[model samples]
Target: MCMKHRKLLTAGIGLLLTVILIALVRLVDAAPIGAQGTSIGLSHLNQFVFDLFGVNMLWYNITDWLGVAAVLTGFVFAVTGLVQLIKRRSLLKVDREILALGGLYIVVIGLYLFFENVIINYRPIIMPDNTSPEASFPSSHTMLVCVIMGSAAMLINRYIRNKPLNRILRAVCYVIIGVTVVGRLIAGVHWFTDILGGILISVTLLSLYEEVISHGK
Candidate 1:
């Protein structure tokens, strides 16, 4: 790999390690003590987050739909890449860099599903009508938005030569990321640590993706 890619990969790995450490801390310090005890999160940051942004169902639903849109955008790119592979009639003809990205997308989805089923952090607020608790840590919506849109932006930058369009695409991705993060937090559907974890892990994955793709290209 080139020096730049090496550096980026190293940085991303470092960030991922840090995020894991944070997760450990959350598990140790933030677990609900007992029925009477408070749910301490990220050293009590969850309460602060709740105070800052109470709850908004509208924002929650809006961001949720946007996350789906982001996933569809990533799917579009995957389809485009698959079409290239079919038309070329040879795996070797497909851009190895982009193929790596397809694998990364699968990894992202797998992680999301794993975390959702495993249950690390519980939601701050229970559903109004439901008795079951919601899994809130490492906000899946946040991760999806970051990974799908972020990956889409990177692919656009790689293929689209028009500087203006490249900037526009990236800007749109950034805006979506911002709104998703803020909206999820304000919606009070997840703890503050959950959002932070989502951002950290997704960015780490994206950085690793870029590093590998750059070397292949």
Candidate 2:
């Protein structure tokens, strides 16, 4: 198959996995297995995993901070684009990669908001300040870290000329994404399905982002 067809196939598969996961969560083994008696899909599996690790606020905090760092990294890119726009006096003058990254971030934010209101599942544990369970489907932290850091890793070589620096940045992004996914899973705040959902959606988004960047080149 051609490159374009291959990319579309990969993205389509990711989206299909995401949809199937959601359906299973809604229709299979669902029970009142979440915090404050909120119903969760795949209750047996989720409860089993929760029992193994229990709650570790430390990991949760660590992953949360890493998610913040990922957002800051995206913010840096946005600022870079803004600086270029201001200096050149035309949005068109900004780097195409940066513009594409901005669009990707916006889509990520939109998905986050959609899941927040749609309420696929509530958190396994109530957060410290919150009185009730929060939306936990697709583990937003995992999704955000994966998308932002994963894309940054993919795009770093194009932005940085220094080989060593580029490698270092890419390695850091990989480590952050890995830690966030694992840490969030063990943090006992989200179901296994939630983490899986996050990963699937990130894969879908990253596939499309890669296609766009590659097409631009």
Candidate 3:
């Protein structure tokens, strides 16, 4: 098959995986919230983690801030992609593709929201006093970090032929993803399935985005 056909096939597979993950998450929801399951948050694990890591005082505060930071970084990329597209409107090659990918990203997220409502009604069940808006089962914040930050790192590595620098940037990207995933897991704010769901869905979305918009028409 040609490159375009391969890309389309890849995108289809990613989409299929996303659908399967959503179904799996819903099936898992058959277990009631508070029985043997209890509240699935990581309060205890996080507590011990914070104490051991010596960051208990700061973990909660930083995690809240990190959520905002992660989203804003995605916005930065979307804006930059748009600007680049406009700057090269006449040419409209890779820049245009990047901008379209950004748009596709939003669409995938919209579907994610709709699926959560219809499938599991998975809303982030946070503490009563917490201020952040509730979104659950596939942490959108973590998903955003994975796609936006991950894409940025991919772009940098693609452009920078320098091996050492590319490796460093990729490593940083991995670190960000790792910290965000672990921090959420430890904080006990999100059920572990919520995070696993988030990661699986995010990977599927990112994969589709790459297969489709990252390649040319």
Candidate 4:
């Protein structure tokens, strides 16, 4: 493997291992505390998060819009690439990149979904009574949006020489990822451990893509 690819793989692995170890430690400690202890701690956090979400109704609006936006964003990029591939030109290289990235993304997403649904089972510490079997490990939603938006924003920032535009776009990417992280934590859809795991997995995978796949092209 090339140096860059090796570096990315190493970085990703390090992150994943660190997250896993931390989680294992937390789980061990948490098991003894029981739900009541977890609930008491989370209640304070919940109130804080809910307030932020309700503030000026901005976060709430964003929360409502995120699901539609994420789906639309993925669709828009996929269709754009398909259209380009049909024409095959100024967009061909980009289209190829998209196709490759999209394929990898599907695999990663499948793994996450499968683990969440079938293999790895962990009830939310905050809401144990939930029967939906929501996968509490690694908030896939946050991780997906982060890598998707973060990678896009970074790529665009590359071609656009404009200082202001690039900065703004990159900032937007950070905001999207940041809010998504906060959203998951505050919404109680996942435990804090879950979100951390998600970031480690997604970042590492994307880093693998960036260094290995991108370098080959």
Q: How many steric overlaps are in each model, in order?
A: 0, 0, 2, 1
Model 4 CA deviation exceeding 4 Å by range: 1-6, 9-11, 18-27, 30-61, 89-94, 119-133, 159-162
Question: What's model 3's TM-score?
Answer: 0.68
Model 2 agreement with the true structure over 1-217: per-residue lDDT tens digits: 9898788799999999999999999999999989999999999999999999999999999999999999999988889999999999998888888899999999999999999999899999999989999999999999999999999998797888999999999999999999999999999989899999999999999999989888945
For model 2 the TM-score comes to 0.96
Q: Rank order by lDDT, top first?
A: 2, 1, 3, 4
The C-alpha RMSD in Å for every predicted model, in order, reads 2.8, 1.1, 5.5, 5.5
lDDT of 3 by residue, 11-53 (tens): 5765676567556555543433422333323334323443453
TM-scores of the candidates in the order shown: 0.86, 0.96, 0.68, 0.70
- Steric clash pairs (candidate 1): none
True-vs-predicted CA distance for residue 182, candidate 3, Å: 1.2
Candidate 3 colliding pairs: 42-188, 138-198
lDDT value, residue 8 of candidate 1: 91
What is the per-residue lDDT of model 1 for residues 109-190, given as tens digits with 9 covering 90 to 100? 8988888887666777766787667776678889889988887788888888999989998899889999999999899888
TM-score of 4: 0.70
Model 3: lDDT to the true structure:
0.60
Query: How much is the lDDT of residue 29 in candidate 3?
Result: 35
- Using lDDT, give the best candidate's number: 2
- For model 4 the local lDDT of residue 142 reads 67
